[model samples]
Target: MKLNRLELDFFRNYSHVEATFHPRVNLIYGDNAQGKTNLLEAIAYLSSARSHRARYDRELIMLNEPQGYIKGEVDSRERTFILEAKLNRGKTRQLWSNGLRLKTAGELAGILTTVLFCPEDLYLIREGASARRRFLDGAICQLRPRYAQALAEYNRLYEHKTRILRDWQENPSLLDTLDDFNLRMAQFGARIIHYRAHFVRRLGEQAPAIHADFSGGREQLGLRYETVSTVQDPLGSVQDIFESLLKHQESHRRAELDSRQCLSGPHKDDLVVELDGQSAKQFGSQGQTRTAALSLKLAQREIFQQETGEWPVLLLDDVLSELDGKRQSFVLNRIQGGQVFITCCEPEKLDGLERGKSFQIQGGTILSQRSV
Candidate 1:
């Protein structure tokens, strides 16, 4: 998958900008807050229909603008297609692919997948379980439509159940339907766990090898999917897992009520990472964590290619600058065979990369486009 062309209007700081892209490597360089990352975000959004930075669609629009637009002419599976997203402040947002309306963001999955490694991702190994879960969700949602649907439904049920748990004392009527919510949530949660288990298994195959090479065989990375204990086998059938989920939910029901929180689902799942048989979250150093995180992302990209038979676009958003010379070289070496966008504060940061187009961005506009 590749984004051949992009156009932005009233999005972020860009009033209007259009540019063609290099399929191999496109470098975006500029000073801070000059929209380099914004351009990458626009391309990434076409696949996931989400901004990695912004929580709300309206925040992606320019100040005082009624709407913002992002359009990409993409090449996927050797065919050309147009993806469009319109963000409105007061009204609903719209997504379209090749002129037909897309009902949900999940519809955009798998068409143009992206493996994004940003500065914040450097802390993945040490961050809490929620961040690792997001790592799984972001990658899986783009690759599996069924997993995406299950996750969305499970999230909705979680929200509903949380409100019920939090307010049942004041409004006892909310308790009337809690059992129904639990059953349905277990159904979806089971599916999500099944998918996550399989995906993390794939990661297990790739990430450790990559990390071993990255660490010069000094560290052996290990991965295991961690979920509620009652669900003994995450890879089991949906019915079996669903029953286990319901059982676990019952076990935690009283604890949840006491704490007034929803804490009894796959929503609390984690990807346990170990380095040399030690918990990476607790023992990994800064450099080790960042390298492990990079390995995980590159492994994710490899998994995407293996599943889809094509390379997903890779976006390295200011992550190269965070790495030391050797680690940066490691990332640059592994990122070939696919379209890549690298953002940095200056063009010199991309000195080792050869043969690509470089865009100088300033004030949300492309100041220049030149071959590097």
Candidate 2:
């Protein structure tokens, strides 16, 4: 899938701007804080209805503006689509698909998916499980609407359970509903684990080979899914996994109450990355970890293509600057046959690239646009 054009108003630093993109490679160049990254953020928001950089939708709006708007024309699944997102302060974000209002962000799945690689992701191997979990959730939510719905409900229930566990001592009545919450959480958690297990399985299959090739046959990469201790088979049917979650919840009920924590569910799931049978986080070198991280993302992109019959858009946000010449060339060489947006401080950095569109950005505006 590819984004054809984008129009923004009061979004981030942009007061108003409209730009058409090249289908192959779109280069956005500007100094730091001049809105190079914001351009990519807007494209991703139009696709997923969520901002990778901002924690709240209101953060996406301009300093004094009460609301922000984003619209993108996309081509995917052999059809064209117009996706829109409205960000209102102190209110829920609204999304639209082809002029029809959408109730959830999941409704925009598979239309304009993107795989973003930023400087922070280079440290994915060394970061905590939450980083890796976010990686998985971000990719899967765009491909599976049901998984997205289940994940949203599971997170909401987890918050309620946390409040109950923390306040049960002062409000004894809250304890009355704790059992009910546990049962419901398990019901949703089952789907979360099932989908995650299958996704990780596919990732395991692809990332390892890619990692090996990236390392030049010198290292082996492995990915394993880890969930609650009581989940024996994460790939089992939803009903069976639900029962397993319930069993684990029962075993942990006393500890959870004692510690005032919500501890039993897929929220704690992790994708274990190993290099040559050792934990990559603890043992791998910087280059090894970086290579492993790149392999994971490239593998994910391949998976998207295999599933959808079209490659997802690849967004590289100042990632080439962070890599060495060898690594930079490796990444650029591999990202073929798909739409790509690369942001950098200098257009000369990618001087030898084939013909594509280039935009010079300044202060949230496109200073100049040209075809190169």
Candidate 3:
């Protein structure tokens, strides 16, 4: 899927802006805090109904504005779809596709898939499990709408179960409800885990050569899905893991009550990034960590293309400036002929980037008609 044009109003730094994009390679260059990231965030929000930066609806609105608006035209499945998002004060964000109101985020899924590579993504290996989990969940959700729904259900079940446990002393009856919740929780949680395992397995198959290429063939890389219940028996169905979850709920909750949280299932799962048979988190250098993160994201894009029959729009948010020439060349080689939206402070920092459509961003304004 490729975005043809984008319009935004009252979103972060952009009060009002509209720009058309080339199907392959578009660059937005500006100094810091000049709305480059905000523009990309608006595009991402229009596509996914959420922001990769984790900005809340209220936070996304301009400081003095009561609402935020985003509109985009995308080429998907051989037809153009106009995707729109409206964020009003004290109301849920509203979404529309080609003038039809979308009832759920699932309706908006696959309309425009994007793999964002930002400087912060370099933390995927060294950060806590939440980052890696989000990486896996977000990528898989875009490919499988049902997986997203199942993950949402599992999280809801986890919250409800936690509430009951927190008030257990005063609400003994909630335990029975918790019992019922755990059963469904396990069922949905098992499905999410299964999808993630399958996703990571595919990543393992696709990421090795990518890692080698990105690392100049000096490093061997692998991705492993680390879950308590997902892989105990690969040949078995999620039902088996759910059965195991149901049986262990009592003991797990008894211990977790002391900590006031759900202690088991997909919520606690992690992705183990390995380099040369050692944990990257523990052994990889800063450059290696970033390389691994880049490999994983590129692999995700290719896998997404294979699964969906279309390339995901690529977003590179100031990620290339830090790479050495060799790695930058490798990165450039991979993104040559795709729809890419990039942001950088200095235009000269990007090699062979000025040849593409260029925009100068300053003071929340996009100067789009000029090349320099």
Candidate 4:
């Protein structure tokens, strides 16, 4: 996947800006807080439904502005497509593709897959389990739309089941409804777990070598899916796990009271990153953590390529300055023939990269594009 042109209006600091991008690499350079990273964020928002940096939609719009708009032309898998996103408070966010309105966001997932590497991503190892879970969900959502749908349904079922549980506590007569909710949620939850397990298994296969290259063979990296429920020989099929989970929901409901539902399920699942025999979150050094995160993202791009028959667009938000020469070179070499959007404060930091296009950012305006 590659973005060919980007247009932003009232997005962050940019009032109106349009730029075309090279297929291989496009670098945006400026001082800190000059909207260099905001350009990348706009692209990410266009690809996905949400902003990569902002916690909410109102923050993404220019101050005192009613809405923010992003439009982009992209090429993926031998087809060219156009995507547009509009963010407005107090109304549902709207999306359009090729000038047609989209009823759902899942329609936009596979059209422009992206792997974003931001400075905050380095905290994946040290942060809570939710961050790691978000990473896996975001990556898989792009490749498999069903995973996204299942996750959404599971969340809804979880909320419904929690409400039913509250009613059951009061009357004890809603047990049947509670059981029905549990069975439905377990069915979908099992499917999500199946996909997550397969995703982590694939990452395990690809991340070790990449991590070794980044860490100079000093550590071995491993990825594992941590689920609360156990799967016996039925691991081959999620249907089997669903049946097993349903069969035990009655007992689980009576014994488990810490939360609204049983704790042993995909909702509580986690992705464990290990270095050698130790947990990376607990034992890895600062550099080790960052390198491991970088390797995981690179592996994600390759996995998306192998599974989808196309490369995902890579977004590097001011990450080049954080890496040493060898590590930067390793990342740059791996991204050949793929579209890349990188943000940096100093153009001199990217001197060794070959055949790249550079754009200067001042405030919210982008200067002329040049080849360096």
Candidate 5:
């Protein structure tokens, strides 16, 4: 997949801008805070209908602007599509594909898949479980709309169950709805567990080899999906996972009531990273941890290509500057055969890369464009 053209109005620092991109690699160079990352953020929004850095759409709007707009022309699988998004300050965002309004953001997935890598992702190995779970969910949500829907339902159920548990003492009547919420949670949570387990399994199959190569065959990488203890086999049928979750919820009923917290289910799931049979988070060195994180992201790209028959657009947002020379070389070498956008401060960093397109950004505008 490739973004052939992009236009932004009142998005981030850009008041009005438009640029064309090459199909292979596009290098965006500028000084810090000159809108390099903001350009990438716009493309990311077009791909996923959400911003990776901003929590609210209003944050993406330029100062003093009531709304922002993003439009992109995408080329994927011998077809062309126009993706558009309108962000408002105090209202819901609007999304469109080829002039047809989309009712839900989930419908935008798989249209222009993207795998974004930022400096923060280098800490994926050492971060908390929430970060790891987000990595899994982000990738799966792009490929499977059903998984996204199930995840949303499960989160809603989890919140309701937590409220019931927290206030049951004051209003004992709340106990009446606890079982209903638990059953719904288990139903949706089981699907989530199943999808996550399967995705992790596929990721595990691809990441180890890449990690070995990145480590020069000196280390072996491993990934383990950790779910509720009662789940005997995460990759099993939905009925099996549902029954297991329900059983575990029953087992933890008293403890949950005492603690007044929802404590059972896949919401607490984690993906364990092991390097040579050791916990990477706790035992791996800085360089080793970074390599493992890089390997995992590359593996994600490979998995997308394997499942979709096309490489997802790769976004490297000021990440190369954070890596050493060796790691940088390894990353650039492996990210071939796909549409890539790399944001950096130094143009020399891309000296050895194949001639693609290069753009200079200043004050939220594309100052110039040329062949690299």
Candidate 6:
């Protein structure tokens, strides 16, 4: 899929702006904090109906603005679609596709798939387990709407269970409902664990070869999905996982009550990365970690393409400058046959790339456009 045009109003720093995009590579160049990342964020928001950088819709609106808007013309599955989103300060965001209102944000999942690579992602290897889990959730949510619904249900159950645990001491009556919440959490958490395990398995199959090639066959990469010990097989059936979660939850009931925390479920799951049989998070050097992260992202893109039969739009937010020439070349060479938007401070960094369109953005406005 590709974005043909984008129109933004009161979104981020862009007050009123519209720009067309090339189906191939499009370079967006600007200095830091000059709206380069903001523009990319808008496009990413269109794909997922949520901002990667902001937790609230109010944060996306311009200063003193009551509301914001983002509209895009997307080409997917041999047809054109008009996707629009309206952001309000104190209300729910509205979303529409092809002039029809969508009931839920998950409805926009498969319409436009995007893979974003930002500077923060370069440190994904050493980041906390939440970040890694987010990586898994974001990618899977876009590809499988069922996973998104299951995740939402699991998180909601987790929150209710935690609140009951936290307040049960004050009101013993709350304990009466804990078992019901625990049962529902197990049902949803089992589905989440199943999906994540399958995704990680596929990622493991695809990422190791890419990492070996990126490292010139000097390094071997591996991925393992870590969940509660009761789960004998992550790839097992839903019933098996549900039983396992129940067993683990029962075992941790006393400890959970003592700590007043929800400590046994998919919420604490992790994706472990190994380089040459050692933990990448604990032992990999800076370069090795970066390469591992890149391989993982590229593998994600490939997995999307394999499942959907088309390449997802690639968004690189000033990530090339963080990589050396060899690694940059490796990434650029691997991203063919798809639409790409790359933001960079130095235009010379793209000098060796093939011809494409280039835009100069300044102060949330498009200054000029030229063929690169």
Best by lDDT: 6
**Residue 167 in model 1: shift from native, Å?**
1.1
Residue 213 alpha-carbon offset, candidate 6, angstroms: 0.5
- After aligning candidate 6 to the native by TM-score, how far in Å is the CA of 318 from where it should be? 0.2
Global lDDT of each model? 0.91, 0.92, 0.83, 0.82, 0.93, 0.94
lDDT of 4 by residue, 180-242 (tens): 777788889888878888888889889999999777898999887877554553335888877
Winner of 1 and 4 under TM-score:
1
lDDT of 5 by residue, 218-322 (tens): 999999999999999999999999999999999999999999999999989999999999999999999999999999999999999998899999999999999
Q: Tens-digit lDDT track for model 2 on 111-133?
A: 99899999999999999999999
What's the best-to-worst order under lDDT?
A: 6, 5, 2, 1, 3, 4
Clashing pairs in 2: none
What is the alpha-carbon lDDT for the whole of candidate 1? 0.91
* TM, every model: 0.98, 0.99, 0.94, 0.90, 0.96, 0.98
> Cα deviation of 148 in candidate 1 (Å)?
1.4
**Candidates in order: C-alpha RMSD to true structure:** 1.0, 0.8, 1.9, 2.6, 1.5, 1.1
Worst 10 residues of 5 by lDDT: 46-55
Give the per-residue lDDT of model 6 (tens digit) for 1-372: 899999999999999999999899899998889999999999989887878899799999999999999999999878899999999999999999999999877788888899999999999999999999999998998888888889888888888999999999999999999999999999999999999999999999999999999988999999999999999999999999999999999999999999999999999999999999999999999999999999999999999899888899999999999999898999999998889999999988689877789999999999998877
Error of 4 at 157 (Å): 3.1
Error of 2 at 303 (Å): 0.4
Query: Which stretches in model 4 have alpha-carbon errors above 4 Å?
Result: 160-177, 233-235, 247-251, 255-264
lDDT at 25 for candidate 1?
90
lDDT of 2 at 118: 94
Instruction: Evaluate residue 200 in candidate 5 and report its C-alpha lDDT on the 0 to 100 scale.
Output: 94
Cα deviation of 283, candidate 6, in Å: 0.9
